[model samples]
Target: MGCPLVSIIVPVYNAERFLNETLNSIKSQTYNNLEVLVINDSSSDNSVEIIEKFVKSDFRFRYFYNTTNQGVSHSTNVGLSQCKGEYITFHDHDDVMLPSKISSCVEILENNTELDGVITIAEYISEDGSPLGTKTALPDYITNNPFFVRAFERSYIPTWAMFMRRDIINKLEFDDNIKIGNQDADFFLRLLYRRPQLYYLSNPQNRFRQVSKSLSKKSTSTCEIYKKHNDVDIAKLYTQAGYSKVVIDYALAKANLWRENIESALNYIISAHERISEFDEEEKDNVYFIYATCLYLNQLFEPCLEILQKIEGKSFRAETLNNQGVCWAIFGDLTKARDYFESALSILPEYIDPKNNLFALNASESMPVRHFTKFPLRSVYKTI
Candidate 1:
């Protein structure tokens, strides 16, 4: 037996500009046993001609075109319906996959039996493949942990960076409703909420092209329409992913729903009422910390103190002490806040949040500070 068969689905629409580079990247992957499916989703440009060119030139590629314009999810489902490989991955037409991408994913997935999927860090680049400073965390979006270095929250998780077992997605399909933006987020969140075994490679394997015209990257009015649709999927994901703490999830979900409801920054304060009753001491304290911060940011310190009081003098942990101190400082209790902050600082020097929050609190306190964990996080993936 040779290498396992892998199927790569490329959904195309008005991608004539970068289609060749994307296709060429797949063709040149170090892993040779693969099928490339290029679904031309009713392109209005020369994309059809470009697909035709690849069809003739590369025997490894097969081309399909829809008579009408279906969205990327539709095209993706069409490609998936045609897959016969043991493993499958999606490659966006405008992105580039490094030579190691396929081989490395193939290597890892073939060995790890429990992982439902793998994610990788990817770069933001202009149309010509020049890098932009924007970076995202793939593990954050993939894993269940928030505030962890799993995936970055600032940007989107590119569709091209995941390697998934075809069977895990068996009978599962992308929601066509999220047509314009965050299609990958919808898909991955569903996978994680339903299946808990997903892990990440932690390095960039795909170059996510941020061609200015890309709908997901736009800031115009049309993008607002796109964002509402994206939030729908996120809210759906939150229904289950937020089960552990509805209050925390509600705060995060509202933050996620920011575009649709412009006053979300205030709604987080309202979470105190929406939160489930009868929380344990720890649970209530955690919820209060998130609540106090939201109130402080929205300049509602009176309520912030109401929550902060519950956590103060409770003697939880160093981190908790620090958070309570910050809230008190915001509530104008400079003396009390400094005591808690100093005590927390003495207990845990490595916890940076207290240090930063305390410095911001006083604009006058001094402390020696260094942040690391012996080995800094260098790559999400270990090298060969």
Candidate 2:
């Protein structure tokens, strides 16, 4: 059989600044049998012009423009409808695919007929293409297990790094209603529900650009609303899939925590704790961490530390230590807080939460007590 054709769908908005680089990355893909679809969602910038130029220059490049400003999901759906290849993938207009991205994934999927899709790691890049860090779609343990647990807890495979068969793509559609992000997670969970064989490549072949204007960075109420909506749907799906209720509760608790709905978060964490027998040691530790986080948020510092004391594992030691520092900071024990933050940093030097907390703590000590009150525990604490 010949190499299957791959269709790369890119959703563009006001991405004129980096659109050319993104297009050039796709053009340079080692995989030659590919069609590039740039769907412009009524961009106010020169995005459409750049896309048109690429289309004119490359026969494999196709351009589509929305009449009105639709969201990324809508633009992606439109591109999905236009794709004519056997295998498919997606890209963001502001990101660039490594030259080997398409070929690497294509080879894996082509070799493994059972796999419905293949996912690769992504390298986080700054606006100017400088390296920020790297992230994997799934954690090491979850990746080794290759089970529903990974899908339930963190189904955050970036669209840019995923390659799916057209048949799978035909069976799925991005929920345009999920306006506040997590659309990719929701889609991934639904797709994984079908129990399709999947593979993960640890090689970082996609450069995910992190910008202040990205949907994830938006903290508006509208974004929160959509995030909660999507989270509710995902939670329900997980419950229906007959996964452990503790995991489900933990997921809901984390979602509520993100929305700052302390009451709901507390309730979910309580449920997870009450059914602690249903979880493994690692999961139980995670539950304890979340429970402590909820307690810390509610200003129950002593009880938060109590829960942290119950947690027993190195898996979440850094985060748990960071939370302990936050609790100590709130209890007017800056010395203890500093010690905890230092301990957390010793555990994970690259962990940003403890570093931020340490910085905030030092700032508070240098400033007047009244001025320090402005930097509340909430501001210093990272979410679970």
Provide the clashing-pair count of each candidate structure: 8, 0
**Which prediction has the highest lDDT against the true structure?**
2
lDDT of each: 0.64, 0.73
Per-residue lDDT for 180-248 in model 1, tens only? 666776565455435445556667788888777885663323224335435345445544444344544
TM-scores vs. true structure, each candidate:
0.62, 0.78
What TM-score does structure 2 among the candidates reach? 0.78
What does candidate 2 score in Cα RMSD to the true structure? 5.5
Give candidate 1 regions above 4 Å deviation: 133-156, 218-384
- Which lDDT value does model 1 have at 295? 61
